[model samples]
Target: MNEFTMNDLMVLMPYAPIIIVAVTSLLAMIAITIQRSHFVTATISVVGLNVGLFTLIGQITGVIDSGAVVASAEQLFVVDSFAKFNMVVIFICALACCTLAYAYLANLKDNKDELYLLLLLSTTGALLMVSAQHMAAFFMSLELLSIPLYGLLSYTYMRNRSLESGLKYLVLSATASATILMGMAFIYAQVGSLAFKPISLVLGSMFESPLLILGAALMLFGIAFKLSAAPFHMWTPDVYEGAPAPIATYLASVSKVAMMALAVRFLIDSALLALPSVQMLLVVMATLSILAGNLLAVRQTSLKRLLGYSSIAHMGYVLIVIVSIGAAADSISSMYMAIYAFTSIGAFGVVTLMSSPYRQSGEADDLSHYQGLFWRRPIITAVMTIMMLSLAGIPLTAGFITKLFAILAAVQGTNWFLAAMIILGSAIGLFYYLRVMLTLFKRPKQFIEFDVAGQWGIRVGGLMVIGVTVVIIYFGVLPNSLIVWSDMARIW
Candidate 1:
C-alpha cells in the first residue's frame, strides 16, 4: 500500500503548481455557489494560475539544476527537469487561455462561471500528467483533462456547430479511451504491474510476446488518436471548428503539449520504443500525419479548421523527434513544443478575439471575415501574419527554429525519410499560409462587424496574443537561449 507519510508531504513540494490549480478549482466552485459572478470566478482562476506559475518558477532554479526526480512514496507521480520545463509552458499557456476565456465568455447568455471551473480542472490534470509515473495516475490524469473539455466545448450549447462538435468529440474520445484501457489491461496481464518502470523491465525480456506486442500496439493507436496523427486525425478540424476559439486554443497548445511530454517520458521509461512493432506504428503515423495534415489544410478556408489540420502536421513533426531517439531528442522536443505552444496560442487568440461565441452571427472564422483586415487593423493583422508565417516555418520565426530542430533530430537519428517529410510538409504549408496572408490585405469587406471593442488591442486577450507573438519572434531570432534551456531538460 502507498501509505501516507510525513515524508510524502515534503516530497509533494515540487507539485505546487498542480496542487494550486486543483485547489483553485474547488475554491472557484465554492465561490460560484455562494454567488455566481463570472468576474469573481474568473479572477480566482487567474490569480490561482498566476500563483501556481510563480511557485513553479520559484522552484525552477533548484529543480532544473539538480534534475532531481521527486516522486510520491508510491511513485504515482514523479517530477524531474523534463516535467518542470514542460510544466512551465503548460502553466503559462493555461494562464493565457484563462485570459482569452475571460474575454470570450463575457458576453455569453448562459452561465459563464462554470467554464472557468472546467478550465482549471483540465489544467490541473495537464499538470498532473506531466509528472505521472504510474498507470493509474496516467489514466486518471487523462480523463480529468478530457472530461472537462466535453463541457467546455459545448459551453456555447446554443450553436448547432458547437453542439455537433461536442457530441462528436465525446463519442470519439470515449472510443480512444476504451482502446487505451484495453491496452493497459493487456500489458498488466503479462507484466502484473502497472508502473511504467516495472512494465519496461518486464517488456525488455518478453518484447516478443504476443500479449506485450498487442498491448503496445493498442496503446500506440490510442495515443496516435490523442495526438491526432494521420487517419485518426479526421476529428481535429471539426473539433477545432466547432469549439470556441479559446477552447480550441487550449486543445492545440496545453493538452497536446502535455500529451507529447507524457509520450516522451513513457517511451523512454517503459522502453516500448525498443520494440520494432512500436517503432513501425509510430513511423507510419508520423509519415501519414505529415502528408494528410499539410495536404488537407490547403483546401480549407476557415482559419480555425486550417489550424486544426496544421496542428496535426505539427504533432507529426514532433513525433519525428520521439521516434528519432537521438541524444538531442529531448532538447528538440522541448524547443519544438515550446515554440508550437507560443505560435498556436497566438494564432488561436487572434481567432478568439475576432469572433464571439455569443454572437448569433457566429465566429468570424471564415476566410472572408478577414478580407482587407490589414487596412483596418494592421497591428492585429501583423500578429496574425506573424503567426501564420511562423507556422509555415518561415525563416526568422520561432516556427522555423523549431522545425529546424526537428529535422536535425531526425538526421541525427538517421531517419532520413522523416527528415524529408519535415521538409516537404513545411513546403506544402507555405501555400495555404501565404493564401491567408493575402486575404488579410485584400479589399475590405463592406459589412464590417468586427466583434471586439475598438480599444481591444490593449485588452487582456489582445495583450496575451501580442505577448505570445513577441515571444515567438524573440525565440526565432535568438534561439540560443531557448535551446540552452531545452538542453537542460532531460528525462533522468
Candidate 2:
C-alpha cells in the first residue's frame, strides 16, 4: 500500500454541506456590502439553504445504504449513513428556520443582514456535531451550535427577558463545555487517541478500569447536559421562556435533534449503550425526566415553560428508545425522532405565529393570551389543536404513531415493566395536553377578538403547520411509508 499520509483526508471532501453553510454565511455577509436590506439577506439565505439541501440529497441518494462513505479512522470526523441521515434532518431544520426567520424578520426592525449569516453558521455547527467522530469536532461543533444561539436568543434587543435568557444560556453552556473538555481529557489519557472507534477498542479490553469508568461517567454527564435530560436540565425552562418564540422552537426542535443524533452515534458505535452501568444511568435519567417533565408541565401556565418541560419528557421517551434498542433497531429511533421533530416544529411554529410582535410578541408565554383564539383565527386554532393532540399522543395523530413505535421498540428490547411505565407517562401527559385544548375552547367572558392577519408570511407559516398536522395524522393512520424508510435507514 502507499504510505499513509494526511493527504488521505481528501477522501472525506465530499462532505461539503458543512462547508457550504460556512461559505453561505460569508455570502450572506457580502449581501450587506451589496445591499444591506433584510429582504435581500433573507432571500439569499433561503436560496443558499435550498442549494445546500439539494446537494446533500444528491450526495446521499444512491450511496447511503452501501455503508460508511469515508471509513478512515481520522481523529475528528466520519461520514456515514448515520451521519448522512442526521445531516438531512439538520438541513431540513435549517431550511425551516430560514423560512420562518425570513418572514418574521421582515416585520421586526432590529434584525439586520447579519442575523441570517449567524443562523447559517449556527446550522453548520449543528451539522458538524452530528458527523463528528472525535472530541475535537465534538467540542468545536458544540460551541459553534451554541455561540450564534446566544446572539440569536438576544436578537430581540428591546426585550429584557431575551437578553437575560441569552446571558443565562452563555453561562450555563460554558460550564457544560468545560465539563465536556475535562471529560475528554480523561478519555485521551486513558486511550491515547480521541477517535471514537479506537477509544472503544481500547476501552473494551479494559472495561473494569477506574480510568475508563471515570472517563465514561464524565462523558455521560456532558451528553446529559447536551440532551437536557433531567438534573442537567435546569436551564431549559428559563431559556425557552425568555427567548423569541421562533428561536425557542428551533432550539427545542432542531438543536435537540442534532444532539440526540450525535448521542445515538456515540452510544451505538462505541458499544457504550450495552454497558449495564451506562444503561442503568440512562434509565434513571429517563425515568426522572418523564416524571419531572409531565408533573411540572401540568402546573405551568406559560406555554413556553410548559413546552420546556414537555420537551424534557419527550427526550426522556426518546432516550428510552435509544438505550433499549441496539444497532439492530436504529431506524425505529430515527423514525420516532423525525415524527417528534415535525410535531415540535409544528407546535412551536403555532406559538410563534399566534403571538404577534405588535401585541403578543413579548407576552407569548401567557396562556390567557390564547383565551379567545378559537373565535379569532379558526384555522390556526384548529392546527394548534391538532398539534397539541398529536403531542399528547391521542389516537389518530402523528404523535400517537411515533410514540407507538417508541413504546413498541422499548417493549421489544426489554421487559414489559418499562413499556408499562412509558404508557403510564403518556397517559399522564394527555391530561395537560387536554387542559390546554379546553382553555382554547373556553369562551372569553366577553366577546374578545384578536387580529389574525399581519402578512402573507405569517399565514404561510401557519399553513405549514396545517400541512404538517395533516401529514402527521396521515402517517398516524398509515405509518408504513415512514416505518419502511426508517427500517431501511439503520444507523449502525
TM per candidate comes to 0.96, 0.92
Model 2 CA lDDT for position 163:
87
The whole-model lDDT of each prediction reads: 0.87, 0.76
User: Would you list the clashing residue pairs of candidate 2?
Assistant: none
The numbered model that scores best in TM-score is 1
Q: For candidate 2, lDDT tens digit of each residue in 425-453?
A: 88889888887788778786374433344
Which residue pairs does candidate 1 place in steric collision? none
Minimal lDDT window, size 10, model 1: 64-73
- Given candidate 2, what's the lDDT at residue 179? 85
Give residue 323's error in model 2 in angstroms.
1.7
Question: How far is 54's C-alpha from truth in model 1 (Å)?
Answer: 0.4
Looking at model 2, residue 412 earns an lDDT score of 82
